[model samples]
Target: MTSFFLIDDDVAARCMLATIIEDSDLGRVVGEAEDGYEMEETVIRYAPDMLIIDYLMPKQDGIETIRRLSGLGYAGM
Candidate 1:
């Protein structure tokens, strides 16, 4: 199965996404981060194939996060 990562700051939203990821057959959640600050490290450790990120967050938004991830050699969008 495909590996997945979630990047969002909302606790309830994260929980809901986790449930969806677990219940769906498309992929599994291998990692999660509450904000952009944790994304780089967490993603590197989990090495997920896909990332479902929120549009807004503290420290850095999804656009910046995507940029950073791209800089780190992540090709997903």
Candidate 2:
């Protein structure tokens, strides 16, 4: 089964996304975060198959997060 890591400032949105993913048999939620800052470690640890990140966040945005992850050699989809 595919695994997913979710990143969003809104808890409700994360919950909803998890529900949708699971209900649709798309994947399992392996981890989640409220922001994009300092998430490389957790992401690496989890090594999920996919990442669902929100575009706007309080600390860091999704684009920057993806770039940072890419630099860190995280090649998840």
Candidate 3:
């Protein structure tokens, strides 16, 4: 099964997405982060197959997050 890591600052958005993921059974939520600061650690811990991040977040943005993650060379499924 595909595993996903979600990062977003909004609690409501996170809840909604989590619900959808659970109901759809599309994938498992391996980890979640409120902002960029936590993303790095969470990503490293979870090593999810996919990362769905918000465009805007405190401390870091999606682009930067992706860039950083890419640099880490995490080849998720």
Tally clashes: model 2: 0
Model 2, span 1-77: residue lDDT tens: 99999999999999999999999999899999999999888998899999999999989999999999999889899
Stretches off by above 4 angstroms in model 1 are none
Report the C-alpha lDDT of model 3 over 1-76, residue by residue, as the tens digit. Answer: 8888889999899889888987899888888888877467669778998888899997999889888887777666
Order of all candidates by lDDT, from best down to worst?
2, 1, 3
Q: Candidate 1 overall Cα lDDT vs. reference? A: 0.83
What's model 3's overall lDDT? 0.83
When 1 and 2 are scored with TM-score, the better candidate is: 2
| Candidate 3 positional error at 67, Å | 0.5
TM-score of 3: 0.89
Q: What is the C-alpha lDDT profile of model 1 across 1-77, one tens digit per residue?
A: 88888899998998898898789877888877889874586686777888989989989999898888888888654
Rank candidates by TM-score, best first.
2, 3, 1
Candidate with maximal TM-score:
2
lDDT for residue 51 in candidate 2, whole number 0-100: 98
